[model samples]
Target chain A: MLSSTVTSLTVLLIVVFLFKEGVGVFDKTAMEEGFVIAINKNNPVDKLSSEQIKNIYDQKIISWEEVGGKKDSIFLFRVDDISNFYTDEQIGENFEMLPYRLSSLVDSFPGVIAFFPEKYLDKNFKGKKLEADKVTLAEFFGGEEWFPTAHPSAQLGVKPLILGTLWVSLGAILLALPLALAAAIYMSEIAKERVRRIMKPLIELLAGIPSVVYGFFGLVVIVPLIQSTFGVAVGETGLAGSIILGIMALPTIITISEDAMRNTPRAMKEASLALGASKWQTIYRVVIPHSISGISAGAILGIGRAIGETMAVLMVTGNAAVIPHGILEPMRTIPATIAAELGEAPNGGLHYKALFALGCVLFIITLFLNLTVEFISNRKKAHKH
Target chain B: MYQIDENKVTRKKKRNQKFVFFLFGAMGYFVVALLVLILTFIIYKGASAISWDFITKMPEEGMTKGGIFPAIIGTLCLVAGSMLFAFPIGVLAAIYMNEYVKDGFIKKFIKQMTNNLAGIPSIVFGLFGMSLFVNKLGFGDSILAGSLTLGLLALPVVIRTTEEALKAVDNTFRQASIGLGASKWQTTRRVVLPIAFPNIITGLILSVGRVSGETAPILFTVAAYFLPKLPTSIFDQAMALPYHLYVISTSGTNIEESRPIAYGTALVLVIIVLFTNLLANGLRKYFSKKVKMN
Candidate 1:
């Protein structure tokens, strides 16, 4: 008894810590994005409207000619080779892949002005000196583009990532539900016990395989399959992501639904058979209805899996930062975006907090779905009683 | 007796047999398809990469240029750590619920909650750990945090298994122990636990297998990356196999180059999972044989 109490108390303490950190991220995002300021001293175009700022951030206004600078050609200056921009490695080792170094490439090109993280910037750059002003930083924060390694303490937008996440997850869940249900029914009610005994473990084994393997499989197999079938130039889109996720969700649905169907008492099936129903008829009318609650629970859990999947969806989904208008359009999911950007996000910065907020949203979604399933199942049991 | 409809009955029975046979064949084919497609592909891709050097080297800056030593170590640490935390607590809870507690609202609730927990998608557990263990407990991205999260993840499974194992112990054994003037604790410790130990070990191995493969919970909690150095202490960071594979395949430096690394990692993980399942099956089979003999 004492041990059990201690166990529960330990669990409680752990939960409290997670929520506290999660909440800290939320608070930080609010303060950073809600109000801040910036000042660019080298160029007088800092006082621009939100729309103009959006265009500039989105790389639409690439040259000083477009935004009014020294000449038609923009002499862009970005951070030199530096480690703080991205790679968690020594400067010599990581300079090759570092975003600041990449930003230099962008700078050297004609009519290109790029930025990187503040820590990467030094006195070497000669173009824009973005002074630390709360108002200007706030203005940059309001834009809808996100390039995390942007120089200065400003100019990071998380809107595209946020939109990308919603687009892919919604698409995947829509695709997975019906197929999963059909497969579950076939496995639970139709398959023989011997077949099920073998099939169940194989499917569960599929679940145990790492997400990275699924990601590669999606990249190599599903992408090509979609391209050939649809005759699209690019196979990576919301639809491809949906299909991969559907495959992943299959075992969860089948296993849970099977358990539920197995729980339906023998008497119920016997009664249905005695009423002169065909085998299929008894399966559809008697067995399915009895296990509907379990089916729903399984479906929700499958959706949760689809929502939270990272690497597979990231690899195949094309990762375009746009709200998907159709199944064929490239999209991203919340988890994918979080994984892609979280490492680069400044620890206490607005972008980092926003990413955490996205996690918070995902948490709420899974939590609500789980609790609802439990509630419905409990009520269902009460009704039966 | 009268006019026997023997032909009609024979024809109907034949049709039923034909349908059942077709259904069974189709189900068998489907099962075989899954096993063949996945296993064949993995083995085909991964087998060639399994070599001595691949097992020993550390990962370089690029995933394509490295080995899976840290990941293998991290996976072992996670499994051992999770077992350390989960086994005792889960067993005790099961003992309390099954052996001591009488049927009531609390027992019923615990049963319901355990079932529900088993059904919860692993990502939620990730979220729970991200919030609860890593940040709240301030065990920031260390092996200990990962283990605690995974321990929570495996607790329900352990509890369920222990409870079932306890219940499966024959009542006569317990009654006989009492008949021999043993106390409740004494009987439980000596007879019930000894008989149930095999099943408990099976459950433990299976749970360890699961923790080793699980990426989502560890992603949120542990998160060691490209660390060439082994963890010298409990609080030190260490890379895990699943995350290594995830990095290699997703944000890979070069897909062509990383293929061998990915293959080797997958081979190692699959071998571990298969071994645990085989171990559990072997133990159960042995015990059942013993039971039959006695």
Candidate 2:
């Protein structure tokens, strides 16, 4: 037991190391490049409407003429040769196309309109003559445009990313908690032992499955269901992400709370029943209060799960950086944002640092939750004594 | 025993019988419904895609399609590499925790730390791997980096399980071994570890299953792009199955194109996990039988 505890502690220490390094890289990255907005030379605009921006991004308006540029067709450029817009040689010999290359390409192409990491926008790129100066990087991120690129300046003056993260996780927890609690109550207090054993493991197994599988499941089933049911053209929205997250969280919450409730002293349950209480009443008034700490802990753990979920939310949340207008609106979350961009962020830049900052926030939340569970469990033991 | 009372007793018996049956059916159905929903869905979607060629081949260009041969090999390397590093250290740590050091402050601190570690999010582990194992150590996009990271992730779980298994062994066995004039180490080696072997195996199997499917930590540490050939060395880059599935599923493409591949991957993953679970269960039972015979 002693040696095992040491080993586990060592692993935890490693986690501390990981977070420090990830954050360290991010900090260095941010300090090196503060902010800049690289705009398209051909489509240089003082400004663009949200719809126009959407259409351009979606490739619906493929010609520069539609956006008041040259009549030539807009060639959407990506950093890598994965797409045909730009050749590998054009990106430079040493430039490995990290994920952020797409944004950089959009900014550089004449008929293209895109964003890039602020640090990468050297004096040469930023100083390149534009037709207009009305649209600044600050206004793009700050004025409610949420294109989270690697460079800080490419944020487009928007805080939508942060809002989207919080809102989706909150919505998922709200939807999942009640259902999980009720199922746990039924499974633990009311079900027979044979039933409990089989049901419990099955639920636990659900938690063990990878979240990416959940993403696929959401893409094929939940997205289409939402689109048809809500009469929307697209179903990939905040609601879809939240619903998928909620389903994933259910098993964790149920199992933890059920185990806690089952461990509650049987003497308490019997006493309640002897005092002329019905089965439901005995469960509600006696068993539940006794295990309230565990239930709360389970809920917190579930919240942590919802917050940390990556692929599922990223796949279904429409990758929009805007704060959601409603549950049905497309949104983004902190974890999703990190997963979506971390691959492309230049090593040791500010854009990378901001991602680490988001990670730090997530870490704090999870740490607080785990500590609270330990604290409450200890308190319950103290009360028993 | 009167005739007038016999009807009431029969009615009560009938009601009790009906209630018990209802309880059993409700609980059974609740479990059955979920199993049917998830398992059937996986099989229905995945069965068509599974072929000998598909299993033996590697992924290629285009959004979807290809076999998972490289992924399977990578998953094995990760699991094997992690165990190679984790097992001895974990076992030694368990021994130290269980046999050495009387109750004290350091012991208590270690206990608290381990508990905290178990609950840390996996993504944090991934970040740590990126910094310490991948960047600082200069392992750089190698299977070794991923293995080390996963080994770290599995450490806490193995330690906790091994300790529990050790504690479960009866104290009397240790005392008897000592009574025979055997040394403490001798007694622990011959009497205690053997008794705990089954539990340790169970723990190890569970850990392997977890490392095999892990994605987030590997996302930063392991190779993401397709590798047509198998990794010949631990230092070589390899593509992991879970990470591959994640990339395919979230490539920002339509699901229709990606569904067949995702289903095949999910089916294979589920089978691996379930098989591991069964293996653990079998070992546990065999050990229990051995204990009974003794």
Among all candidates shown, the one with the greatest TM-score: 2
Please provide, for model 1 over A216-291, each residue's C-alpha lDDT reduced to its tens digit, 9 standing for 90 to 100. Answer: 6677678988999998888998888887787777777767877888788899999988976656667778988999
Off by over 4 Å in 2: A1-162, B1-32, B60-65, B252-255
User: Across residues A1-385, which tens digit of lDDT does each residue of candidate 2 receive?
Assistant: 5446556556556656645644453223111143333356545454544335545556788886787766878664422343465566755565554324555554566665443344444444522322222334344334555554522223433357667766778888898787777778778776778867777767767766667777777887889899999998789999899888887888878888888899888888888878766566676788789889989888888887887778788889887776678888888877787777778876655455556655666677677877888898899889889
> What is candidate 2's local distance difference test score?
0.72
- Give TM-scores for every candidate, taking all chains together and pairing residue i with residue i: 0.74, 0.77
What TM-score does candidate 2 get on C-alpha atoms? 0.77
CA shift of B272, model 1, Å: 1.9
Q: Name the candidate that leads on DockQ.
A: 2
TM-score of chain A of 2: 0.67
True contacts kept of 2: 0.33
Report the Cα lDDT for residue A352, model 2.
57
Per-residue lDDT of B56 in model 1: 78
List candidate 1 stretches off by more than 4 Å: A2-15, A29-188, B1-32, B57-67, B101-141, B167-182, B220-223
